[model samples]
Target: MASFGIIGSKGRMGQALASAVEEAGHTLAGGVDAGELPGPLALQADVLIDFSAPAALEANLKVARVAGVPILIGTTGLDDTNFAAIKDAAKAIPVLQTGNTSLGVTLLSALVKQAAERLGDDWDIEVLEMHHRHKVDAPSGTAKLLGEAAARGRGVYLEEKMESGRHGQTGARKSGDIGFATLRGGSVAGDHSVIFAGEQERLTLSHSAENRTIFARGAVRGAEWLIGKPQGRYTMEDVLDL
Candidate 1:
């Protein structure tokens, strides 16, 4: 079995990842939190799983690259530069980043793409997501990913034309615009829905996380799967073989 190391080992998601790694019968290489990357990081395992904060992403990735360890990164709200750094690092070592690690969410993306294709542009597409209040990021990375799926279905770039929400004086919903709405409340682990709206009927695809461990389990699974792949940037889709 491949060995595993977990960054952000003290947080709920980090603890969950550690537990999942053990439950999967993999050796625990080591665990580190918001400090200098430990020397042991280089020796601990075949893969490192980073579920840390956005502020620490650069350092975490630096450690991974310096250690020559392939990694699975689960942090969200990465800006364009951060994502660019990840893609650049993948040229030397395998690196994976995902908004949601749940296998179901990956499948949900595929289904949303198919739905968007079949429904055509006349049907409006919208993404609604909710997460714990403590979670940063307004629209949630999953919402953007879902919106991308819809955008791909409709053959448009989400960055150029997507709408987040509407207020007073807003006219009718624009055709070909994928809308996004966000809610932050309670301790919701994570929830996302992709809705296709038409005049009278609508279709929705949704997933709700009951606990944080679901993400941890999937992250560990992703680390295990990534360890043997050729050096490249990847997503949960690759991990799930979707």
Candidate 2:
């Protein structure tokens, strides 16, 4: 059994991960809260699971690299700089990063990719997501994940084709660009949908998260799968072999 170290020990996801680790018959190496250092815990772990804030990602990767341990990052709201840091860290240690860790979401991404591939640019793509009121970021990571999948199918990058928060005299929606709409209210765990609009019809793929445990359980499963891997970046798709 792997010793899994949690980087956000006091949060809801952290608590759920602790329970998940035990349920999976794995050992908990230790954990760190927002202000605590994870270096010592990393040294003791076979793998590290991070659900902490985006700002702490670089430091967490450094400690994981120093300890020569693999890490699975489920933290969202990351910027380009954070991605650059992750890419660098992957050169030295195995790193698995994803917006949503739920296995169902992974499958949803694959389905979205396949649909986008089969339906061409003629069918416009749009993504919608809703989360708890406390979530600070617009367009939840899962929406981006699905958008990226769609973009990949269309042989493009999400960064270049993404459109969000359009207001005022936005004359017309671009032909092939992917758009996103975000909703915030109540205590929603998570909800995401991707719509493909054609001439007179629409096809939508969606996933709803009922609890944080789904993410935690999936993360623990992915973290266990990350053990003894070569230095490289990975995703939930790799862990699920989708």
* C-alpha lDDT score of every prediction, in listed order: 0.85, 0.94
- The CA lDDT at 46 in model 2 is 94
Tens-digit lDDT track of model 1 for 118-236: 88678988899999889878798888888888888777799976898688899987778888999999999999999899889999899998998888888888888888788899998
Candidate 1: lDDT of 157?
A: 92
- Give model 1's TM-score versus the native structure: 0.95
Candidate 1 accuracy as lDDT: 0.85
lDDT of 2 by residue, 1-242 (tens): 78999999889999999999999999999899788999899989999999999999999999999999999999999999999999999999999999999999999999999999999688999999999999988888889999999999999999999999799999899999999999999999999999999999999999999999999999998998899999999999999898
Residue 238 shift from truth in candidate 1, angstroms:
1.3
Candidate 2 accuracy as TM-score: 0.98
TM-score of each: 0.95, 0.98
Off by over 4 Å in 2: none
Q: Which ten residues in a row have the lowest lDDT in candidate 2?
A: 135-144
